[model samples]
Target: MATMEWIAACREELYALREELHRCPELSHQEYRTSALIEKQLRAWGIPVLDFHLETGVVAKISGGHSGKLLVLREDIDALPIQENTGLPFSSQVSGVCHACGHDIHTTALLGAARLLSEHRDQLHGDVLLVFQCAEESFDGAASMLAHGIFSAQTPNAVVGFHCAPQLQVGKVEISAGIREASCDSLTLTVVGKGGHGAHPDECIDPVVMSAGLLMQLQTLVSRRNKATDPVVLTFGEIHGGSAPNVIPDQVLLRGTLRTFDNRVRMAHLAALEDLCTGFCRALGGTCTVTVEKSLPPLINSPDICQQLLTSAQTVLGEDCLGSESAPSMGSDDFSCMLEACGNHGAQYLVGTGLENDPATRMGLHVAENIFPSQAIEPAAATLVQFALDYLN
Candidate 1:
């Protein structure tokens, strides 16, 4: 079939898959229905589904007619906790749950690629592993799958995954090498102090005052302590203290995230945060406890894998679809855990998707309330399929 005709024939199926997933969005380890849907489809396509040691994920292997190196393609199958506001016909039906991050699109693209490749297995040169991972929204899923022996079982020479970008134009692919995303650390700080009556100013230690001071000092770390060239973001996303304005609460809780591209910078930021919190609480005659949870390492793409992706993308979608080297983002991805597990096995990782450059239209990461157009599905699937074919050949 001609390329246009082939894509057009598959378009409805792909969009239907995306819509189905979007309507019934699940979060993290709670993707039982989603996993089953993907598994059933792969089985129907005649692909061999492996026993996913991780309970909430699926891995389907398609070995080519001739023996060669193994290649892996991954798609995260978890949705965010945001409520849907897109108003699309296929918008999330589950209240307070949605695929705002485009995992539905990624999953659909990979499933389409898997079906196409399985049908053309006789023309392939090596084995292919289609990995549908869960709990990418959390820090545990990739590490959980890796620890359960998925990477060792497949032992692929290269692995690739992509995310949808609302900023990029429809039907285009954006590629970036090196540090594509930052390390993420979620921190919760509790400041304990003495409570007092609303009119008694001298009796209370005022933990709220200390918490505000600490928040201000945290921002200065990026501006004064870190190098100008280094990218670091310290955000205090939430704060909770007294219930009523008249009451001087005994404790205040502060929650935020830390993002950085450099390991040294990440460490430095953590150390500074600890010191600042401790010092500020002590000065205010209050006790403070800070907990860092769900931390993920920075995503660094392997050089060889990136080059292979560039070549594959250029061959399939032409040079105009490829993007220049862009700076690393402050976002975090669970794929970093997969890369860490397969790093010893000579695995290379890369990302391809759409990104829009307009700042006004861009929403917050993952938790935003919007729907990116479904036009990216075919192009992404085609690029991945062609890349796998090129690698296997």
Candidate 2:
């Protein structure tokens, strides 16, 4: 079947699947219902399905008649913990959960592509693996899947995935050769001191004061320590300590995020953070504990795979749909784990699809409740279809 004919055959079914998935959104690691829905759809279409090591994710495989290379396509199957606010007809039915980050769209697009491929199985080469992963919101899902041996069975020659862009036009595609996203690390610091009466400042170590100093110093990690040329963000999002204003608290807690694109800079910044917090607390006659947890690594696209994606996107959507030199986003994705697992297997990952056309369209990241137009869905599916065919041919 021709690419357009295959896409047309599955367009309506894809829309229905997308809306259904959108209405019943599930958060990371809790995608039981979503998994069942996806499994059922793929089974009905006669694609062979496999349960993920993590119960919340699914993997399906389709084989072409001819012998060629294996290609893997992945989509995250999770939502965020945000209340829906888009007020669309098919807005999230789960009140405190939403597919605001367009994972719903991504999954739908993959499924649409799956249907198209299943319909044209005779034209396909080798095999195509459809990976629906869970827990992208937390950095752990992809890591967990890897640890549990998801990719040990079959490694693809190339892996591909895309994220929805709220800033770009709906159907447009963006490609970057390397360092497409920043490395993310979560940090929490506990400051300990002695509690005493507020009036007796000398009696207490004053954790609140210590916390303030630590926060100020943390900000300097980027300006003073990190290279100014590299992108770095140190943001303290939460701080908690004293119970009452009159009582000097014995302990204060600080939580924040560290983001950087360069690995060397990321490691150095983390080390400096620990050293600064330890020194400040010791000098202030208090105790401190700094725990840094590494999240996703920087998303680096392979040059050859990036070139293939660029060519395929231009062929499908023309040169106007291609994006140039877009800035790297600080947000991280668990899909980076898949890329890591496929190391030396010649895998490549790229993000596609721009945000809605209107400048006033206010869509929140990941968990915000907003409905992207259904029109954007078709072109994204079509793009993937063309890209997959190009890879196979």
Candidate 3:
């Protein structure tokens, strides 16, 4: 079979595999069964599963017919923490967790590409690296896999990954050349101060008072400092301080998330935030600590690579089906972290799985009712395989 025909022939098995993944969705960093299934599937096809020191996910390699540049195709194999309410027969068997982000499709599509690539190795000039990475929802999978040396032995010349886009209809995909995804920094700010009676005005440093002021000023980093055109989001989802209403707590914990589109702006804002927090707290006779758990870097698509994928997508979906040009999103994918490992020569695309008439299928990712139509699998898989052939050949 030709490059695209391979996926069409294997659609039935691809559907079954995706459903199998959807039914037993696994959470980030806990994808033992998912990883095992991937390992079994890849090994069954004579592909070599690399001996990496990863706790979850599988990394396999497909050697081309000859020596050339390496290409890495990654797929996230983890689910979200949401409960399944899609009402499908293959609804998530695991309660309180589901593959609402369409990772089932992502994993299965990549698997389909593996099957096609395995058959069409003669068309490729270089090896293809398959990264079924884990812990994407936690935003630490790519970084953790790097720490474990997933790419230490075999670094690719370019990388590619895909995510489901609920807004676009099935058979369509979106790709851009620059800043496709944002940088995320999960932050925990601890406001430390003297504990005393709430009634005490002078003796108690009052962390509650300090936290309130800090939260208000944190907004200024985006509004007062950064360029208005470049978007930034700083949101706090949790705040815990005192147990008693009459007592002033010694410490207040503020947990928030920061998102930026540019890495240069991201770094500057991070430093500015720490300085602002420290100075603001000390000026009020208190100390504040900002513990930033960095998640993902800005996802930048290589211009040359995007041009190649555009041709690949055109072959599968036609030119009219290509999405209209749009600006990049503030969303972050852990795949961005792996881009740095590959010398920043990669791009991740948004594969549209939404149906125009089916509201449930069109629901945004991470929502309990979000589900993808099975029709999305074959074409998505074919596009990826074609991109590999186009770039490497």
Candidate 4:
């Protein structure tokens, strides 16, 4: 923190930018305004921008007059579909769209680093790619950009990304040497049954009842079937069935997600879930259709790259500001796609953004009550700038 006095002096501007971005939060592929703003800012700073095939993403490059190794610095710019309730002065103006996951902060920090690095380009030894990615909330934004030939121009030697961590206080960072986040896959189960009038006793095979039973049975997949030592999280967040009180619906839809670390465990869980859903519905004289949408894979950090980042982090922010070990999480991220696309030459870390000594201001990501302090912008932005400089040099 002491090594970034320059970033401290620019904190006010970064905070204002963060607030400005927070107010106009956009969801997934709909970050048109956000992308335009980022591109405009980079261009204004004399940095060259790339007009990628994406609808709402910007890829910019900064060369230090001599290119050696290319380093990619990524910051996801998409917000969630949640509504704002933080009551901040710069709360989201868009209804039913909020930056609950702190993408606003991530975007601001990247912009800040861009400005700082541009100012000191003469001191850089290589090229830096700024990836303001969109639709990260959709789990396919990175792939979209890649499909549009994001890497067709030049493959990066290393890719680095950061996410705001509310669990840790501002001025701290967590770098993982192994798996940081779990793989995610969504499952939609459609249970079909006979529709009937409420007065009928045996005329209908009730889907609502079968769905309820299936939900209970699905809970056992993790607890009973999977090994206790293995980690897996199965959550059913959406379930819809009949609409009327007197009539039973023919089909009930169940939407849920499965998160796991190991590939074998993830595949086994999917197979088990499909089998259980099908078997339960068939035995009940009904039919079930299961559809699985594959999402992000488990985010695994490259040990060598993480070690380099660890050393750089300790030098820039001090030892106390860097955690010894990152706590594994069931939460998943599409940044894993970037690492996989880069051929395992990339890594990610968490930048603490929670307020210090203010428990009331600290909350988990993607929650309605989540809110972070603006002062956190300085440390986060400074860390990004320093990391880029360290890696490039």
Candidate 5:
């Protein structure tokens, strides 16, 4: 079968694989079953998997009949800590864990591409590396795999990967030139104060009050300190403190994230956040300690690689399916780590897997009601295959 015909023929198998993965979702760094399934599938296709040190990641290589450039195609295989409410028959059977971010689709699509590439390897020229990476949700699985030198001897000429985008319609793909994703830095703030009765307003140095002030102050780093064009977002999603209504806690813990497009801006924001939080707590007669856990860098796509992938996408999915120059999001991915490790020659594209054009039916990533269309698997696989073929040629 030809490229398109082959992808079409394997749609059922791809869907079944995706559903199986969805039903049996696994968390980051704990994807033993997921990794084993990928290993089994790749080995069945006669591909040679390199040695992997990470517990839940797998890396396999497929070489054509002749020698040429190397290409790496990666897929993240992990589920989020979300209970499924999608009401689908294949919904997560594993309680409190679901493939809400569509990693299931990503895994199945890459598996489909693997099958097609293995079948068409006779017509190919160069080597293709399939990386079924793990723990992309909260853990930096990509970086973990790289730290073990998974690709020390098999560096690729170019790399390509994909993510599921709910906003765009099915069969569509989006490719951006630079800063595809923002840099992510996690923040932990501890406010220490004297504990007393909540009713006694002036008797105790309330850390809860200090934490509230700190949260409000941090927002200014984005709104007042940073330039409008810089695009900075600081959001605190978790705060834990007091026990009872009348009891004032001795300490309050704040957890949040910092996202920025530019590295300089990211650093500046982190510095300002620490300084401001410390100052605020000190002025309010409380002590504060700010801990910043640095994560992946911004995912900036190489313009030359984007152009090549765009051409491949247009050819495979038609011109109408191509989305470019769209607004970049504040969302971050550990794929940035993969790109950096791959010599910064890779591009991660967004594949629209929404079931319909209507917004109501479209599901957002990490939401409890995520319903990624199974239809997108074939198109995504086809585009990725085309990208590899074109790059190798």
Candidate 6:
């Protein structure tokens, strides 16, 4: 039987697994139950599981009848900390946690590929490494796995992964070469000042004022420092200061992320941010400190490999469903770490999950109410399976 034939045979099972996963979402590094369930399913499919001894996550292997190349198929399995509002029959059972990022779809697609590919082992020319990873929500799962020697024994010839796009219709697939996603730097800036009664405006240093001024300065840094063609985003999502209406807080905390398409610009922006905050605050009788705690590099895809997958995906979704020149996204993914290991031999693309004319299904990812039709799974899985077969054969 062909790959799709095998995939079709297992479609119902895949849907059940997806719902099972959706009903019980787990947070990053806390996917013990998720990992166990994944391991159980892989074992039942007669695939060999590798003992990575990971606290959470699963790694399994499917060897070809003849060996020629090694390809890695990776998926992230962690959920976001968002309350469920879709009210699907299989809403997240966990409180304050849901698979709002479509990781549930990614995981299910990879597992479907695993099952169908295992059935086609005799026809395969290379092995497939199935990586169901955890902690992707924090953008360090791939790095953490690499640190623990996930690729120590042998590096793969190529790695492939996909993220669900809620904005695109379900039958379409998009791939782009070069920089496909932005790099992310988590920024935390603290403005410190002397606290005083609100009534006495002259006595207090007024860090709230300092923080607001510095945020505007940060925006100017992005606009003036970077080229107009190069995109940069500096967002301060959370601002916290002052406890009461009558008293001024000693300090204010501002947390945000810096996303940039260029590496040099990212570095320059970081330096400028520190200088701007320190200089701007001290001049106003306050002090500020900026901390960049975590960073994820831009997702760069291989042109040649992207073309190969474009053809492969066209076989699954008709030729008209393939797109290769779409604008790159600013969202970040940890899969770029794996691409860094394999050089330009890997690519990650977008799999459309949106339904036409359905406002409810068009909500952006990471939103609590974000949802997609189940019909989107077949094309994604079939495309993955076909790509693996084409490359390996």
Q: What TM-score goes with each of the models?
A: 0.86, 0.91, 0.97, 0.91, 0.91, 0.91
Model 4's alpha-carbon lDDT is 0.86
What lDDT score is found at residue 232 in candidate 5? 87
1-393 per-residue lDDT for model 1 (tens digits) = 533345567898888888898899999999999999999999988899998566898988998988998888888999888898876888888988898878888899899889888888888899998889989988778878877778776567777878776656655566666788889899999999988887885888888888888888778888998899988988888999998887889999999999998778899889988988888789889988889987788888877776777777777667787654455678788787777666622222233333465342256446455556677787778777877888888
For model 3, where is the 10-residue window of minimal lDDT? 1-10
- Angstrom error of the Cα, residue 63, model 3: value is 0.5
Mind sharing the TM-score for model 4? Answer: 0.91
lDDT of 6 by residue, 5-75 (tens): 67778889999999999999999999988899899999998999898778888889899999889899999
The prediction achieving the highest lDDT against the true structure is: 3
lDDT of 6: 0.88
In candidate 2, stretches whose alpha carbon ends up further than 4 angstroms from where it belongs are 344-369
- How much does candidate 1 score in TM-score? 0.86
Candidate 2, which ten residues in sequence have the lowest lDDT sum? 344-353
- Please report how far candidate 2 places residue 64 from its true position, in Å: 3.6
lDDT against the true structure, per candidate, is 0.79, 0.79, 0.89, 0.86, 0.86, 0.88
Q: Taking the tens digit of each residue's C-alpha lDDT, what string does model 3 give over 184-280? A: 9999999999999888858799999999999999999999999998889989999999999989989999999899988788898999999999999
Better of 1 and 5 by lDDT: 5
Let me know the TM-score candidate 6 reaches against the reference structure: 0.91
What does candidate 2's lDDT look like per residue over 1-393, in tens digits?
A: 456556667678778888999899999899999999988989999999875556688888889888898888888889888898877788889979888788888889888888888887788877888888888887777787777677778777878878776656666777777777788888899999999999998988999999998888888888887778989999889998888879998999999898888778888888898999999999999989999874677777888887787778777667787755677778777676788778822323334434444432435455354456665666677777777788887
Clashes of 5: 0
Q: Pick the candidate with the highest TM-score.
A: 3
Worst 10-residue stretch by lDDT in candidate 5?
Answer: 354-363
Candidate ranking under lDDT, highest first, comes to 3, 6, 4, 5, 1, 2
Error of 2 at 297 (Å): 0.8
Candidate 4, clashing residue pairs?
none
